[model samples]
Target: MRSDSMGRQLLPKRIALPIFASDALSSVAYAPDEILLTLALAGSLAALNSVWVGVAVAAVLAVVVISYRQTVHAYPSGGGDYEVVSTNLGKTWGLVVASALLVDYILTVAVSVSSGAAYITTALPSLAGHEAIIAVTLIVILATLNLRGTREAGGAFAIPTYLYMGAIALMVVVGVIEWVTGNLGAAPTAHYDLVATGGHEEGLVGLAGAFLLMRAFSSGCAALTGVEAISNGVPMLRRPKSRNAATTLALLGTIAATMMLSVLVLARQTGVKIVENPASQLTLNGQPAPADLQIAPAISQIASAVFGAGSVFFFIITAVTGLILVLAANTAFNGFPTLASVLSRDAFLPRQMYRRGDRLSYSNGIIVLSAAAIVLVLGFNAQVSRLIQLYVVGVFISFTLSQLGMIRHWNRILRTRQSGEQRGRVLRSRAVNVIGFMMTGLVLIIVFITKFAHGAWITLVMILVVFLIQQGIHRHYETIRSQLRVDDWTAKRTLPTRVRALILVSNFSRPSMRAVAVARASQPSAIELVSVVADETEERRIRSEWEESGIPIRLTLLSSPYRNVIQVILQYVRTRRKRSPSEMLVIYMPQFLVRHWWENALHNQMALRLRRALLGVPGVVITVVPWKLGEDAEVEGHQLVNDPFKRPTTIPSPSSDTLVGPETVEE
Candidate 1:
């Protein structure tokens, strides 16, 4: 209900790194595998080139990180790519990037959780085939953690991120020491021969080889998936938000590139051979490898080779890598809701997403993202390889649009600037943006060519659908705004000059009597008690009771042959409005306020229908005169009063010289 706590400051550099960079940093755990997996299509010798591919990917990642650093510094209000594209290009381009980023953030959660589940299943064999269940459970847990608020979720991720970094650094150091001492050993799978599938194994070696290399490069681009996340999170950074976010982005790029390159190098040096189906594709001494021979992850293999099998350090590295991959989705958690909030404010999404929960986080957005990711995980059976195909495309789509946007952003600034430091900065940033636009656009093209058939098209379709939905939402809000506009006619319209009150009576009970009393106090020009004669016996008893009370208001009966109370009253109100559209008809319906929840079932649903019908008739008002039962009155004394009818009466009556006491309305 409160405006989101803007008093919350940005993240400092130390905290910002883990908060914004965890996704990219954690990709080192999987990027090596992806590179090797893609090249393995061409056979083991082709995968031997994976180290070079990793380096190329690392270079691209460095360029992107640097480009985004400039982006963050230039537009630190934290619209991220959407802001960049919208400002530089146009609103439509900005919307496209926003939609792409939204889709990517969702895939990030699904892929990260599924990958984490795979690692867990590898660690615990009994959990096999339950991957979807485990993945969804992890998502739910993460959603709950995020719902608790951003700071707590960030704190939860901090340790795992640092632990992952420490473990990878230790592995790298140990691997280097072993290599220098000539003691580095081959991985357990190194002795197995890898049988390549697909036409990639054909040694045509010319343009075909170049295409294969492009494919490998495209696969390795997975490392760059989370690079832009830091820029999206600039608002979460501390004072000097731009500077802190840039530093965090730099640290993220350096560490991630180092870890990924080292893993690839170590895998190559150790003669590691990873296959799609290890049990069938791997051969030992010209025979198929054992079916139960678990193929450890690329990082796990490197860890074991450096630290020796079954060592504590090996287990530590394995556990930490899995933990960090699971927490990697936390980056999406932070980015998705913030971006959703921005979109919602722009009317491109449901405004509910902008409402924060008790913990001051966008709880609705978190739940929505988690639900979407779970659907993808279940639909794809939590297979990381297939999900990986659907990745990179969205990230690169955003990347291309954002860079182009930044170029435009800088040009606008340049036009107004003179030969000063600001001008130099703008020119330098423009150069970075230009380079980024070309590089990202080319990679996007490669990704589409290499992966579109492999399920990347699914992501594109999803982005289009999201874009259309956003456009629809914007149109819907626009339509509603047009409908609700207040013009001179609306402002100058006068309330009805007179009130004609009617008390709906049945059997002349205490409720009906109270309705009449409240209606008379309003000083209506004409007051009457109306009852429906659905049955002769009931109508006779009501008339007898009314005559016995001898009330001042006249009692009248309307015969209903079809026994329809709502229809009869609605027809009468319509006739009255037709006769005197300028006069207000106040229908006082006697109702009982009950104490227990189930007691609501005891009442007729006719009141709801009557209220809806009356709203459409001009100059007609429906007031519910609630007669509290004894138990309801007692319960009301104990509970907070939120019911509109039961609120303390504020309007003064002409007969009362003094104000009514609050206690008078308590019953």
Candidate 2:
């Protein structure tokens, strides 16, 4: 739990793979579904294009993984794409990437958790229509685990992630075997006839069909969402962090590509049909499918066809699929906080985000990510179809910018002379980045052009807003630094000419006596016991107690025509400050410190108001002297030296002859 113990939290490749790769790996659950759904708009024959669409998506995923591997090697401080773009492309572009990544990270959590909730409904029909509640609960749980520390979260999530991977792998292997043996069963919905939309009845025949394919490709690119996280998380890995991270990236790319392509291939073989408007587009026996019929996701249908609907393996696959979807949010849990800490260190975010919690994790960023994800979930009602519309836009923005930065990075390296082998390697890296840039850049354009009207514009607007907010935060910090800079050391450190102390007394109590004792101990040039009184009887009682206590300070009463105690005190203090502007006026306020929360309401209302009112006054210091209210409120490991209110018999009295009058404000 100590800061020094952070080294113990370093993750090995096995654990890091699951933690950083879960999001990308889980994309196989829904990316294929998205691809098929988009393709299904053009009829079942057009839906057969799902395999090639997945192939194109996997190719981009491969290039992005390779490009980020280079990124991790070059900039392993864990700033990831933001650092890459900032260091090579400059801070403005860097901030653009940061904002984009921030928005994407939020959408990642929202989309992943929502999709997982959908999977839960796939297996448990009774839980349908409550995806928002389920998704919110999963986010809260992930946030709590991550608050404990990244390593513990990794350990907890590793099993389900691996289980999901294994489930997919098994389904793929079994589906292939069943196909070769000619025993592959058809999906439950395979019997339904799909009707192409009016414009696309011809199915991939013209410019419209090509545009639809591009749209499907963009939707399938969601698999690339979490690939960059490994680069962002190199600091969390063990020794040789970059190499381990790069290796994990390669592993993630291979596994995700394999799972996605295999699922798509198997979906084609098993004739799995998914459509956006299932009630309208699908027909059974020449009749429209029932409006209330629930359509299972592509993966669930594939699992049922390959492993039998009610089999144990079927349940295991669906269960693990749902769990991995939920755990995919863990990737954002790890990356968002780390990225936020970097931004905070750079003064783009609040300094509190840069601080580690007791468990040595960025607790503020995790909680913030959780809250944002929950809001998005509730706002969209936990519908993956809707949330996915806003998903990949930000991530691809970061991707395109990072690859461009990497190319620039290599160019800078090549400007300096290198040996033959080194030059060859650098050129190869640059070439890879170039390919990555073109691929991701093209994908970014396509995604924006295709999805802009379908809620991607919301993401773009959010990114721009985040960018402007960070710029403002940075400007604020810069302004503070400039203003607080000490140009003249002597003048900045010089003490006030005289120290004048005033104790605000309401009645004769131990707390008030303690405040008076503290004021006298300060040995100020002048001291006064001041009271704001509206009632003559109360003033008389306070004067009586002061004389009986034998305190050497002069007692001054300020009369309040109205019972505005705080206003009366403020007027008196401001008038004195106007009279002696160069001296420091220290106001000692006695307050009771209670142990219970409700007890706060019973006390300190006046002290709170007085402190707030005096805060803006120049040359005024409000000092709160807390008197503990309970027996157990003693200072730890030490007893009180003596009773603070035990009045000293030999107190040095002030040179004043008598107490000031109620109208002392005139002087």
Candidate 3:
């Protein structure tokens, strides 16, 4: 609700990187947990392959990042996946991509904050019981900060993001050093024996082992969750927006891939053991682990073992990693607004979402994103594991469709541009997108097959609902356009042959007098002071003054037996409209403008209702002549009468009837 200046909203690369890259970078905090948790289902042998799954996921990340870099260059308008699919695949698939990305952004906020809360409870046992509350609090903080503007939020969040990257890098370095120098030891739970569940204790075998590997691979694909955020937010970047965004995407890919793979390998090297049912699947010192024992996340356990538990370096990594996870949702804060703005421009979202706030941010979209994320947090009770099941499905859906759309886009371009280096570039870009689509499509199917019943179905349903809603909005807009279209330029718009100005006289005050003066200046052929006589005493006082003052305009009285001013005015308007539907019926509704918002409630109740009810009458125009309550309402009233801009040109005539009063003047 402030200045929506464009310059203030443009983000330089330094700030934009953090704005869009936070989610991808923060995935290192929890992606490992998911990978380890899923692999641990089949015991240690499957767990040993965690690093391999991470490698496969990182490869997909590489292809996706490359594909999206091409995307930003090709379509710099910030619609990202939605634009690509809509341009090449048609509006329906475009809506599907938008719906998937929209759902993905919401889940990113929920899953990131939930994972952050898990890290908090890991370091501080006292806060374990309030995870959902803590997660929602984090969402509120993020929404508030983001509403301040993208550049400001990026500035505020940049430090922690840098610190998190540094911390993770340091952890990896310290971990490798400890591993090389023979100083690293097993994690706190490394000694706990991991027992295979569902009678697979002997070890993974045959088709079942292959399926377990596939499931772990799908789980690890969570690392790719936030990779598309940079592409979705190209317009937010400074000049050369697409180039800067593509570079940021590359930076994100390198950092996220490096961190995810290193952390997984280190977690595996530290002999970190994780099981979904820790009490039943894990045994410590030859006895079943305590049923209520809290298992720290894989990142936490790795940090502890590598840096030595309780050390300053270890605590710093733990704190910043958690901070990064909370800030990871910042990516969605930037993404959803930009994407929603595009949707709004395309008539798929509310016009309000297209508006930038005084802070030059999409405040409405931010507020809505926060509300939805909070609902998810509350619905899942802030449990990271539960939310994770619903997490990557949306992103993968978007990834699969967006890449396919990009391929179509490049092919369409290749056909248009033949014989040159441009053709070569197009072919290369298409190849990258092809690889990206195939990789992501495979992961999407794997995720669907492995996690569908576990909660991915919920995300699928959500995407369908959003898709339908967007389609409805598009249809509604199309209908409005069809209804409003003009077929001929010479078509006539109706105008009154003779003006009839009805000045509503609520009381004999200066404000009412001003209304009569302006109406007379408008030079209507037929002008009358209309009033509903609620009380005979009030009516008598007005008529006595009317005769004494000798006001030239005729007064028309309507009897309101039920004291219902609005109904009486509506009846009069209806009758007048029926008598002269082709003529302009100008209803001069005078009002007093008060300074404060609450003062509005004190006045204008009748005038407001009169305006609303009379709108149904064809050819009726309600003109509000407002008198400011303080500091010369009468002077401004005369100004309203004489100001050329205030009085309609068609109404002003050379031989208009003059109002005989000190404030009324001949113009």
Candidate 4:
């Protein structure tokens, strides 16, 4: 599509919801499981606390959504947390937010795809051991879809997201009705007993138990990872963007929190057991569970109990759950690129990231995010449980900082207006942000403290590395700007003392003759055709042709005993510049224009090498004289031919007394 059609890409709330909130909403698939698994580390009885953990996580999710609603309305330029922090605090704090979000977005993809792979294997047990391979394949597919464009991806993924939501809601309603009727049966694994860790045999006692509960709560907070995506993507929304984005955030919070809490409540009622290590921590009858036991996730168990295990509804819910989990990465796919484009605009990243592709999407950022996620998935073997340990740290960091920035944002507004309805609203918003700041700040600390040893340190280190690298890039750009800044146009426009053209001649071919003719046309102070003598036979042919052709320009040969073409030519150019510092030296070389990729392999790329080496030399300029090859040389937008070397009417006087000839001279 043409770039002008970007306006057509603005997403309405229906499509925008799935595109931006799928990650947070799809957390229902695994967030409850994580809470249950962490609680099961104590004992079967202690696992019952999952309901309370789910409630805590849901409450936090609600507050974060409310806080970001204000963010979208106040700063709808799509900078999200980075803009909030940078505007309120400073650029350094903004960099902190950007680095955290970047790392978190990558982890979102890795965790979501890995969790999706786990669900797939649950349905098809035959594909159990190759989760990493399946996950990598899924990522490649997702990347391809996103490369097509954002609105198209949203359209492709919307049905599955809605179906997953409908499936979870249906299961919850069915489970509740069965409970009311006293017909809900226990899960298939409900009969197995959980054995607590060695130190927690007594269960939920002492400070250790309190610490364990905090860890479980932190694990459940993974549900909040994608809440900021809507705020980051405000620019992609249709008109009334802030209002639509806030509405979407509200919808996300309600649906995601309700689904998560319902799943945990259902798991508790139906006695679905999941543990960190199912083999050693669970027992059937009197012996440890079978070594190869496959523990279905909490949602699957809940579905099986609510609807018979063999029921079609159970498989439908399972399939949709797996698909939604994979589609959840689409949220990051949208957020990461938009956020990267913002950073790129601010000069914190490469300028390439700021340009849109043919699809009007940030293609570079999408490719980069996919590559990073694939590395994480492969490195961790696509184990959601293990990968979850490294999750949420960066997100909570961003959440905490964003809330604090929002609080400051409201305070600034209140100071500007007093004694009116606007002041009252500003004060209320400030109160909300203050609460959000406190809640998220505490959760951030809990996540870091609970998961640091497990793998959260890796996240912190990555954020630090990204921050330093961006700082270095910004500083380098600043240095270049300062160096290139022109203080006086008069001094900058001073002319060179003389212009000397040097033609790079290889043989008496049409390409070489064209180079000499173009150089002579320029009417420089002097023109000298030079060649490097790499082989004796080639050198003799060139010397014979130059004398026979009687080219107006003189020929000079530079002997290369080491057969290093580029170095020999550069040495001579530098020596000439050292002798006459104010004269401008223009080096012209012949180059081929190929019609096909393979045609390029037929000739040497000496001109390319020479241009690269000459670029860094002071007061030197290089030009390429193209010689078109292959059929269809007269392609539109490309010059078809060059003027033939008409022996120049007259040769200009040489700048120096030195006469040029074919005799070899050592540099």
| Lowest summed lDDT window (length 10), candidate 4 | 632-641
Question: Clashing residue pairs in candidate 2, if any?
Answer: none
Better candidate by TM-score, 1 or 2: 2
Report the number of the highest-TM-score candidate: 4
- The TM-score-based order of candidates, best leading, equals 4, 2, 1, 3
RMSD values, in order shown: 6.0, 2.7, 5.3, 2.4
TM-score of each: 0.88, 0.94, 0.87, 0.95
lDDT of each: 0.81, 0.89, 0.83, 0.89
lDDT per residue for candidate 4 within 62-81, as digits (tens), equals 99999999999999999999
lDDT for each residue of candidate 1 in 1-667, tens digit (9 for 90 to 100): 2444654634567766787787888788888888887777677778888988887888788789899888887788778999888887888999999999999999999988888898888778899889889999999999999898777777788888998999999899989999989999889788988776656566326666677778778878888887888777787777778888888888989998999999999999888777777766778888988876777789988888999878999888888888888888988998999899989999999999977888888898999999999999999999998998998999999999888888888888888847798798788878987888898899999999888898999999999999999999999999999978877796558666767887877667666766766776676777667777776686667767766766645666777868887778777778778887877788998777667779889888666677787778776788897777775454333322323223235533322311222110000
* Stretches of candidate 1 exceeding 4 Å from the true structure: 1-9, 203-211, 290-293, 420-422, 489-493, 500-515, 525-580, 585-591, 598-622, 631-667
Q: Which sections of candidate 2 miss by over 4 Å?
A: 535-552, 630-667
**Alpha-carbon shift of residue 281 in model 4 (angstroms):** 0.5
